[model samples]
Target: MHLFADMLARVHAAAAAVLGPSADLTRIVVEPPRDPSHGDMATNAAMVLAKDAGQKPRDLAEAIAAKLLADAKVEKVDIAGPGFINLTLKGEVWPDALRTVLEQGKGYGRGTVGAGKKVNVEYVSANPTGPLHVGHGRGAVFGDALASLLVAAGYSVTREYYINDAGAQVDVLARSAFLRYREALGEDIGEIPEGLYPGDYLKECGAELAADYGDRLKAMPEAEWLPIVRLRATDMMMAEIRNDLARLRIVPEVFFSERSLIEGELPDPFSKEPPKPLVDVVAETIAALREAGHVYEGRLPPPKSGNLEDWEDREQTLFRSTEFGDDVDRPLLKSDGSYTYFATDIAYHKSKFDRGFADMIDVWGADHGGYVKRMQAAVKAVSGGKGQLDIKLVQLVRLLRNGEPVKMSKRAGDYITLREVVDEVGKDAVRFDMLYRKNDAVLDFDLAKVIEQSKDNPVFYVQYGHARGKSIFRTAAEQGVLPADPAALQRADLVRLTDSGELSIIRKLALYPRMLEAAALAHEPHRIAFYLYELASEFHAQWTRGGKESPHLRFIIQDDPQTTQARLALVQGIVTVLASGLDLLGVEAPEEMR
Candidate 1:
C-alpha cells in the first residue's frame, strides 16, 4: 500500500467536507513534515484553498484539522505556520506498513497508476557506425531503466531502438570499411582521409568482406559495391552493438530501421539487387503535411550571426513548425534535392503513431537538446495533435580517476566505448553510478571511488545495506532467536517492532511505491537511485546507532526472543525494498558483500 497516497486521499476527503464540495483540491498535497519533531506528515489544504473558500487560512486549517481528528490513522493534527496541517499517524500504522512490505516481498513497490496504457520509449538509437560510446551509454541505461520503471508502475511499455541506417554517417562507415578492404587486398591505403572513420574496429569487417566476396566487390563500381559493403558493415556493427547491450543486460524488444521506411532496393548481401519499389516515405509524409496546410515552400531567415558562406537563398519545402511551439519553421529538403534527417524521422514517428502509440518518449544526447522543440512540433503536425512526444536529453559524462580526467585507450577507438567502462567495473556499478544524478546534469564518473566500501560509494553502500540486513538475520540465527528462512521470518509479529530505529526503516520502505510512481510519471529514473541511497543511509545509521549507543536496541535480544524476531523482520523488510528498487534500476543487491 502507498501510505502517502492514502493520507493524501484522506486529506482531500476532509477538505471536500470542510469546503462543502466547491473547494479546488487539485493543489492540495500531503507530504512528510520538514521537521520530524513537528509531525510524520503535513498537508496544505487550507493555504491553497482558503482564498477561494472565503475563510481565514488558520480558520480553514482548524476546520480541516477537526474533520481529520476522526480518522483512525491520524493520531495528531496541528495547525502550524500560516496554514499548514501536520499529521502524525498512529504508531501501529508503521508496523502495518512494514507487514505489507513483507507480504508483497519483491513486488512491494509495484503500482497501477498507468492502468496498462501503452507507452513507446525510443532510446539509444545511436547510429550503427561504431561501438556505443559512454555518451550513448547514458541514454541506453537511462532508457532501459525508464522502461523498467514504467512496467513496475503498471504501464505496458515498448522498449525500442531506432537504427539510423539511412543516414550519411553509415555511408562514411561503409567507405571506411571499403578502405580497410583495400588494405586487406594487399594495397597500402595511406593515412585514412579526413572524411572517413579510422577506427581499427572495421578491420574485421574488411577481412570478412575479403574472404566472402574475394575480389567480386572490387570488380564492381563504387555505386554498386558501396551498398553491399554498407549493408554488410551495418549488419556486423549492429550485431556488435547488440552484444554490447547484452553485456549490460539490455535487450530492446524492437530494433526499428530507418532504412526500412524507404525500400532497401540497393542490394542484398547475397543474390542480385532487388528492384526499387515505388515508395518514398519522405515524399509521402511531406505531401500529407502539404495537404493538411502545414507544409509550404519558403526560405528560412538567415543565421543569427547573419553569416553566409556561398549560401543559396532559394525557397525549399518547409514545415510550419512556428504554428506549434517551435521558434521557427524547419526545412524538409536540402539543396541537393534529398530528404533531410528530420524528414525521415518524421516518417519514423508517423510509423509509431500508426502502430497505435500516442504516448512517445525519445531519449537523445545532450547535443540534440535544440532538436526537441522541432521534433515535438513535427509530432504535433504529423500525429494531428493525438501524439505526445517527450524528449529526455542526457548530458555528457566525464570519466576521471581520482580528481584528474581519465583518457580513452587509443587502441579501443577514438573515444571511450560503453563496453570499456562496463568491463572495467561490473554492469551493476556502471548502471547505478550513471543514474545517481539527474539525466540532464553532467556526470563525473570516477573510476577509483565507485568500488570503495566507504559511504561515499553509493552502489557499494546500498548493496552493503542489503548485505548487512542479511548479516543481521545470520547473527540472529546464531542466537537461535529467529528462523533461517525469510518466509518464516515474515510470520514474526510486526507489532513488536516499536523501536524508533525499527519504525524508521518501515517508514522508508513505505515510501518506495510513491517514489516509483513519481519517477515513472516524471520519466526520470535517477530518482530511484537517489531514494535507494537515502534508504541505505537510514539503515546504516540505525545499525551503527544500535551497535555503538545501546546494546538493548540491537536485533538479537536473547532474553526477549519476541523483540529479536521483530527486529529481524524489519531487516528482512529493508532488504526486500532495497532489492526491489535495485532491480528497477537494473542493479544487483548482494546478500553477501564478499
Candidate 2:
C-alpha cells in the first residue's frame, strides 16, 4: 500500500539493470512531484548515480526510463531537465490504490520499517515530588505518540517512566507534608519555609498521613520520621501523578524508580548455586567503566556556563566522557563519596541495556537539554557502543487564553497542572495541540482557541473530518443508496472516481503509509498531526465543493448508484485513515463532533 515505496523499489530495479548490481541506491528517493503537471511521482536515481555510472545524467535517465516503461503499471516516464525522472502511472492505478485502502481498512498504513526492533521509550519521567504540570504534559504526549507511531511502524516498543525519587527534593516534599500533617492534628504551623514545597497538593498527603499514623509520626525525630514521611509523601504524589496521567489516557508500562538503582542490591548474574554477595549496580557500573578505561581520578576545570558551586580544585572520581564526545570529563561522585546524578544515571541506562534493550530513548524536559551529551556518552561507555540512546528534549508549553497568558493553578501555586488543562479543554485538544508542533520548538497552547469548533482549531477540524465521513455514510443509508455494506462497497466501480477532487483524496490516502513510516523513522509525531490536518482540509474542501456544484459531483448521487458507491468507498477510506492517524497521536476520532 506504500505507493512511493513500491515505485521506489521498481526504480531501483531499473537502475540495477542499467548500472549493474554494485550501484548504491541508498540516496535515491521516490516522492510525489512538487508540481502536479510534472508527473504522479518523481525520482532522482539517474542524477545521483550518473557520476559513478560514467554517463551523462540525461543519458542515464533515458536508460532508466526505458527500463521503467517496460513495467505494466508505468504509463509514461519523462526525463526532466538534467535527469530527474518523473513517472505517470496508468489510469487504473489510482483506483487500484483506492482498492488497497478499502480492502486494508484499519490495516492500510501499518508498516514494517521498524522490522520489530525493540525500542524503549522513557517519557514523562516527572519527579514524584509534585503533580505533573503543563510542560510535563507536552513530554508525555510527545513520548506516548512517538511510542504508538513506532508500534505502527512495527517496532516492539516498551513505554517506560523513570521516577526521580532519590533526591533532596523528596526530602523537601516530606518536610512540607509534615507541616500540613501538624495542621491536620490541629496544630498551628504558620508560613511554609522558603526551601520547602509550597503546593497545596501536599495537604492531602499530610491529611492521609495524619489519618493513618495519627500523632505517632510526630513523636519520632527527623531521622526516624523523615524516611516514613518521605516514603508516604512520594507514594501519594506519585499516585496523584498516575491519576493525572490517566486523565490524559497515558499509561507507561514501567515506572522504574531511580532510588532502586543505588539503594537495592542485585544478585550476581554470573553466580549460580548459592548466590554470591549482592552487588551494587552503581558501584558495578563505575568498576566496569574503570576496567574499560572510561573512568579515572581527575580534576576538572571550572564550568563554561552556570554556577561553579559544585566545582572544586581537587581530585575526584570522574568518567572520561569527553573521550566519547562529551563537553568534558564528568564527575562520578560528589565530594562526600556518594554517587553523583550522572553516575546513577549511567547505572540506570546500563540497567536498560542489561534488560535486553540496546535501543533507548529518553524524553526529557527543556531544562535537561544540557544533560543529553553526557548521558549519551554514558550509554556508549556502558553498552560499549552496542547501545543507542536518542534523547528528545521537549521544549516549554506557553499556556494562553485568547492570546493572553493563562494564570497558574491554585492547587500547584506556581504552575498549572496537566490535569487542569486536560479537564478543561479535554485530552484530545491538549494532546493534538501539543503535538501539532515539533517537539524541539516552543508550543503556544491557547486555551480559548483549542475549544473553538473552527477550522483554525486543528483538533476540531481533524476530528470533524472523521465525523463528517461517518455523516456521509449515514446520509447515504437514509437516502437508500444500495450496497452500503463494506464488502459490497469494496466491489464498487472505483474507476468512476475520475474527478480531480476524488483523485486528490485518494492520492493523500496513498501517502499515509509512506508519511507514517517517515514520521516513525524521524521520531517526529507532529508529522502525523500535520498530515491529518491537510487530509482533513482536502476532504472538507471536496465536500463543500460538492455542496456548491452540480448534484453529480456530490458524494451521494441520486440517479447514479455506481458513482455514489465509489464515492462512499472514498469516504470509508478517509474515515479509516483519520481514525488510525488519530489513534497513533493518542487522540480520539469521533463519529460525530457533538
Best by lDDT: 2
What local lDDT score does residue 259 receive in model 1, on the 0 to 100 scale? 87
TM-score of 1: 0.95
TM-score of each: 0.95, 0.95
> Candidate 1: which stretches are off by over 4 Å?
20-27, 47-59, 80-82, 269-278, 305-312, 484-488
lDDT against true structure, model 1: 0.88
Q: What does candidate 1's lDDT look like per residue over 477-567, in tens digits? A: 7767768576876778788877777777788888788879888989989999999999999998887877867888877888988878888
CA lDDT of 516 in candidate 2?
90
In angstroms, give how far residue 304 of model 1 lies from its true place: 3.3
lDDT of each: 0.88, 0.90
How would you encode candidate 2's per-residue C-alpha lDDT over 357-459 as one tens digit per residue?
Answer: 9999999998998899999999999998999999999998999998999877968888888888988999999999999999999999999999999999999
After TM-score superposition, what is the CA distance of residue 68 in candidate 1 from its true location, in Å?
Answer: 0.8
* Residue 256 error, candidate 1, Å: 1.1
For model 2, the stretches where C-alpha displacement exceeds 4 angstroms are 22-27, 47-59, 80-83, 265-279, 304-310, 482-484
